[model samples]
Target chain A: MRRSLFPRLGLLLGLLFLWLPVLLLAGYAFSDARIPFQWGGFSWRWFVALAGNERLLAAAWLSLRVAASAATLAVVLGGCIGWVLARQGPFRGRPLFGALAGAPLVLPDVVTGLSLLLFFVLLEGATGWPAERGATTILLAHATIGGAYAAVLVQARLATLERELEEAARDLGAGPATTFATITLPLLAPSLVAGWLLAFTLSLDDVVVASFVSGPAGTTLPMVVFSMLRLGLTPEINALAVVILLLALTSAGGALLLLRGVLGRR
Target chain B: MSRPLLSLRGLSRRFGETVALDRLDLDVPPGEFLALLGGSGSGKSTLLRVIAGFEAPDAGQVLFEGRDLAGVPPHARPLNMMFQSYALFPHLTVAGNVAYGLRREGVARAERHRRVAEALAMVGLEEFGRRLPHRLSGGQRQRVALARVLVKRPRLLLLDEPLGALDAGLRERTGFELRALQRETGAAFIMVTHDQSEALALADRVAVLEQGRLVQLGPPRAVYERPATRFVASFLGGANVLEGRPDGAGGLDCPLLGGTLRPAETLPEGCTACALRPERIALRSGASGPNTASGTIEEVAFRGDDSLLLVRMPGGAVLRVGHAEEDGAPPPRGSTVQLSWEAAAVVPLLG
Candidate 1:
């Protein structure tokens, strides 16, 4: 209309510059004020002192048990390694299994959290098993980097499915575990619930792979809001970053309403 | 007796250096609907994916009723394919894709909701089982892929190009609702099409195939009036050849313009073709016909209740007649017309 209202007002001022710092940490999480930038008014007082903050509820129960065990082991090992890299084909170490399953998306998350904390300290000095690096080695190092972004978004949604609908579900009798639990798990339920809520929002927003395979009981919830924003921005760290941004916006609005009811019924 | 539900015997495959099924043999008797046909790289959907065991036939035997099927995979093949992309299951709904092969044949949940409500009321989609194959309609996802292979009553079904993506008016009412759902689910269906009028309107026997062998297996009117070669007489239709040598008494007297024809007894001794069927040629003028002659009209066409023409004969070949008179002798182009027929209506053919 008038150059579409100035590019929709510069995309609503670039989405209010990424939601005005999560709307000022959800308005100072009912600010009563531990002297947060002035407006010492409305009081939930850091949501009632973050309900008796016993070490910030033990780092929000070690980030909800390592983001629900690294989003249920990254949705069952990134859905059987994204359905065997979408029905195996490229053969012979398919480019070294697609660069070691997309090298945790181009390395450097502190070099994949210091080489998975030096391969869990050389597998606990060779086979002593996990033997502590905490929260089961930060849920096996955030299920190997959030199962490589849930196996690259469930291998780009199993490359638009149809391996002849699993050979028409193995020609309609369905073996191989009932053709993968009744037709490839209900046709990969919206990319397995958006790759398990993007691997539980990347293991509840990892603090650089829990600052290298954390210890002393794997301090999670983004390493206690990165040590309460290095002891500064504390309105009880904006009420635990507005309750982990309303639990990652109610799991990304229930994974966008289960991916709009599975892409509106396929 | 029931053993011929699907046999195969010498099936073969290849793929690497192209040969998608060579020594292929077949049988499918049980309820027998069997169509196969050919054309695009034949091996008719690779012999319906090696009789629905989702393929794997390097050398022979598939057997089924007689049992072999070797590693018998495709979900322990009792058989059920239907796929020319009616692979339905887009996250199930038409009664969960017709109770997904009746709950993989374990059946029960009230006999899988009474055989997925009697196979969605035998494809007339009984309220289309709570809709979903993208809210149905490619002929209701081809009758919900024929109510998911007629709710798993599979003794063998296969299909492949079952009415290839419909619409030629729902492939003429899904070729009689797939020959009345293979005669009300009698079973042994077999399919795979390259559409020769959908294998002559739903075969009772039609095998054909080409680059992958089985040159001609019979019945749809003996592969359309005896075609065993010259690529099954031009892939099943327009015939009209003529060729030379051999004399009368139904031997090889191929001279058809001024009579004296009859050549099909496997025309050999210095052989040539014959096949005529363009409404058994009959355009006469100064006809004291033995087989009459003359040629000139070179091309006409018309086609609506028939017209065709083409002519050019008097030894310079070109036949193609077909008439039904939309103004009969409007034969102008180079005109000179006269063509006739009836030395036992020609037909011989080989070249």
Candidate 2:
């Protein structure tokens, strides 16, 4: 009984430690008072105020658009990269390619952001192709890091797949493209979906890289939230936090249901 | 025969320091069942893969219907392989798996369904079409793999250790089913297996491989009774090999047997040894034949149908002799007995 008590206490403490801040934010979101951490009364005006904030609404929309695009791009490009690394045997420069694929995993986000900034600057000067840094630049930056994450997930999944499945497909009259479509792609669907979700969450939460690449007019939701917190605490920001939390939770739940339905059929 | 449906001319494949296949030439006629028998890493699998176009030979031509399969891919080849693992797609139903080949060939949906039903019926899995591969028994999955390949109506089928994954009882039953199916389909089959009994039972012709070389290729009986090399003799079944020198006549002077003995066939110039099956040697109370060795029985083992007796010769060599159970009670251990065999049972092994 005593031994079980310690583990039970540890689990309770861990849950409290993680959820206390979110609970506090939720409490303040409903407070009538303008100052945070001091509840005057219960009111829904902050949520109404949040709905009226046009800049916040625009930033939130931009973040969603960027995350959706980045996640999609990551799934396609990163899936290809992973398939090459896992299936193509001992090609020239394979070690170099492998190291590059793993670079984003170990490199600091600050370093990655700064390097992307420099790359965009040089690219703009030489090619005049991304004339201004904004949502496009931010999308490219998020995709680069998100694709790395997707590649790692996909490569791990491919490693466990049976090689004979693809060979059997070929033996049954499937060409290389047909085998990839009919055999490899279906087998990898679950991992690809999971990787896309992870990249979507990562891009949604990312502030550092977006700050480095985003233009003055194109502030993302994280940048807005960060700037708001830096100035002073406000109930409106707490309301926005509550809203974002609900959105994240609802999407995560929806993704779970979607994955269960998709994978269960197999 | 029948223009050699498939012919391999001087096929060779090397993996760095090790040669997987060394200048191997083979021919498979239409509707023939051929078993490539060898131990692990003996190039039997390599030969099958080469013919299937999975592994390209370093220097040789794979001719199918007299057309060189130089740049032909596995998907384009008129052959399908049943992997040792069965390699059924876990995501597809039995009918779906069997239909995959036809679907890839762009067959119409109606035709594909009809053929899949026909194939499933052929393998006795007509009612199992809706079930997934993982839900089936090991034997059922094996049948599904067979159906998947057979649905393609391939000119040749490559089977890599087809029954290696089944239990002993299931293996025996599946062996008969596979043979019957092959006869019904009338498609050439090239199966690779290390089980000598399985090969001899299922294959019309058995090709024995040793260290990336074809040691012998003949009918199962010929390969078993008249093995061409010392390796084939020991690998196929039990054999007592005695080192000997040709006596310049029709006999061989063997030190292990303690006497010169006549060989069944004329010994070629420089024959080195003679291989005799243990069951062929007769044990009697006294010396009675030209090829006779007086020895004391060292051990007796009862194997239900036969009793194996180990006889120790005067020169300290122990030779195994097998006697049928109904022949009589085996001579007691340590009892003196004379072992005799007919001259025709002795095969002259050259190397």
Candidate 3:
């Protein structure tokens, strides 16, 4: 009985350790106080003020656009790399390709951000495209890192899928291209969704990579929040946190439902 | 008969140092059902894959309808395979899976639906068209896989361990249905299996493989009754093999039998062994006769209709003798018994 109690208590403590800070921030979002954590009473003034802040709103919109684009790009790039690694049998440079595909995932964010900044500068010098770093640069940088993560997820999922499914399709007179389209792609849909969500969340919350890539015109929401932290804490920042947390939770729950619904039918 | 429908000549495949198939040669006549029987790692499955164009042989020629299938891709092959796992598309309904091949070949939607229904009905899965594979029973999934291939209307069909996944009762029933379906479709079938009884019951001809080489191939009864090698003798029906050399007096001096065995057929040159099926040996109570040996009953096993008695001779060699339940109670263990068989029942085996 004591052994069981210890594990149960450990599980509770683990949940609290992860969620206590977010719950406190959410609680402070409803506080009617000028100071962020100083609770006066309960109110919705900070949420209304956040809605009216034009600069913050613009930053939020820009971050949303960047995250959506980065996530889409990551899925495309990562899905292809994962498919090749999992299905395309052994080939020359496979080890090198595998190591390179995983490089962005293991590299520190500071190192990745600095190297990407230099790369963008060199590309600008070579071809006058992406002429000053901004949202486009931030999107590309986020996609590179996110693609590595998505590739790992997608590769793991593809590895577990039965190869016989594809073989059976080929035996049924479907060409290679048709077999992949009809069998492999549909089976990969769940992993692709999960990968896209992960990439979106990573891009949405990333500050270090975005700061190094963004120019004067490309400040994102996390950058705004970080800058605001340097000044002083505001209840409006807590309100913004609460809003983003709700959005993340809702989308995660919806994704779970979608996956469950699809998988349940099988 | 006519031209061989599928001819495999000098087929050999190696995985690094391990040989999966070794200089295998086989021919399947049109509409014939052939079963490749072997133990694990016996190259039966590899042979099916080579014929299906999934695995390339290291050196060989696969001729389908007299055309060398050297460069042909699997999707372009004129045959289909029902995989051992039954590889049903989890996302597609039964009807959708059945229609997949027809749709790939550019069949009209109306015609494809008609043919899919016919195939489903052929497998007695007509009402299961709208159900996904995972929602069905294992036997139903197997039928759906069959329907998927039958709808393609290939001249040849390969079945890789078709009923390996089912329980014994379901396996027997499904195997019967599978044989009936093959006859109804009239497509040549080459099935790979390790179950010798399944091979004998269903196939017109059985090819027994061992260590990647064809050890014996003939009609089921011929291969079962007159196994050419010691391996085939023990493997097919657990026949008791007695090692001996020809005595040059038209008899085999077998140490296990404690006497000479004069089989009905002329022994091949250098023949060193003979096989006797368990059922051919009769058990008696008292005095011994010609072609009889005295032994103590070591064990008895009851198997529904008949009981098998294990008789140990004085030479420490044990022989299995089948005693039908209708033949009266089996002799109990530790009892002295006489084991006898006619000369015709003793099959001479080559080394």
The DockQ leader among the candidates is 3
- Tens-digit lDDT track of model 1 for B1-351: 555877788888988999988887777788888788888987688778777767788889888778887787888777778788887877668898778776777777997888788888887788868777887678888788878877778767888887787778779877888898789878878788887878887888888888787887877987787675667776777776566666634455445443455533445445456666676677778775346667788788877787888887666667788777654546667888787776656656544
Residue A247 error, candidate 1, Å: 12
TM-score per prediction, in order, is 0.36, 0.92, 0.91
- The residue pairs in collision within model 2 are none
For B1-351, candidate 3 gives per-residue lDDT tens digits of 699999999999999898999999888999999999999999998888888888998998999989999889898999999999999888888898899989899999889989999999999998989898889998899999999999998889999999999889999998889899889889999999999999999999999999789989999999999988899999999999988768897778777767667788777788888999999988765635446788888899999899998888877788888898889999778998877788899888875
What are the TM values for chain B, all candidates? 0.40, 0.96, 0.97
> Residue-wise lDDT of candidate 3 within A2-62, one digit each (tens)?
4668889899999999999999999999999999989989999999999999888899999
User: In order, what lDDT does every prediction score?
Assistant: 0.76, 0.89, 0.90
Ranking by TM-score: 2, 3, 1
Candidate 3, what DockQ? Answer: 0.62
Which candidate, 1 or 2, has the higher TM-score? 2
Worst 10 residues of 2 chain B by lDDT: B283-292
Per-residue lDDT for B178-230 in model 2, tens only? 99999999999999999999999999999999878888999999999998889
Q: Model 2: per-residue lDDT, tens digit, A1-266?
A: 44668889999999999999999989988999979788899999989998999988899999999999999998887898898899898999999999998798789989999999999999999999788999999899888888998998899889999999999999998999999888888889888988898889889889999999888766888888899887886788888888889988998899788876655544
Model 3 residue B223 CA deviation (Å) reads 1.3
Q: Highest TM-score among the candidates is held by which one?
A: 2
Ranking 1 against 2 by DockQ, winner: 2
